[model samples]
Target: MTIRPIVRYPDPRLVLPAQPVTVFDYALRALAADLLETIHAAPGIGITAPHIGVSLRVVVLDLDPVEGARTYVNPEIIWASPEMILHREGSVSMPGVNDEVSRHARVRISYQDVDGNLQTEESEGLRAVCHQHEIDQLNGVFWIKRLSRLKRERLIKRFEKMSRN
Candidate 1:
């Protein structure tokens, strides 16, 4: 397993939609492993393939507060509840800043596992929020996008001011 470098925000590549995995072969599996390594190395809860310069519909997340990580290939949110839950969200791409974002309180996701087995799981609370955030990355969307335009602008300005000091 290799720790892949993460692509930060405003990198341009993050906006491009990811490609679908065609050959679910050894290389693909290796990529997944590398993604897990990279996420763990960053000590992050989730990562998307595009962050590592791989434009594929892949995401890895460790919502487990205790042990174990979960990898998702072609993950899709099949169902989401209308109830909104606001959580303080941050991103590996957008480092050092966290903002409150509202997301579905519960969601059901379906994806293929590492062994090529199809799996579906229902999640709530932090796990649900993480899944939504990671899945958004898979679609080239960031948490900031969920914020209002004025809020996003202010956040960007704040980051820029901090960077100069």
Candidate 2:
């Protein structure tokens, strides 16, 4: 598995909707493995295929803090609780900046495993927020989009200033 470079914000690809994976082939499996490796290397909790420019509906999450890795293909949030929770979210793509975003406190997600088996799981707390955040990435949405308009504009300015340097 190799470490893939994460595409940062302002990259048009980040806003482009990802394509769904129709063929579960060896290459896809390898990509998933590489994604897991990259996430582990980043020491991050979650990653999406689009982050690396693949533009596939895939995400790797490791919230276990002890277990290995959890891979999700074509993940979708089937249900979410009305209760919302605010989490300070950061992204590997958007480095050095954390923003508070309100997301569902609980969610039930359905996705396919690396082996093509469908899996559904309920997550809460940080795991829930992380899953939703990563899933949003697959849909060409970023956590900053969940913020207020003024906040998003400020963040864009900040990112642009940083990129200029």
Identify the candidate with maximal TM-score.
2
Cα lDDT tens digits, model 1, 119-143, are 9999999989998998888888877
lDDT of 2 by residue, 49-69 (tens): 998989899898888867867
Instruction: List per-prediction Cα lDDT, in the order shown.
Output: 0.86, 0.88
CA error at residue 61 for candidate 1, angstroms? 0.7
Candidate 1: misplaced stretches above 4 Å? 65-67
**Poorest 10 consecutive residues by lDDT, candidate 1:** 62-71
Backbone clash pairs for candidate 1 read none
Best by lDDT: 2
Residue 92 in candidate 2 has what lDDT? 81
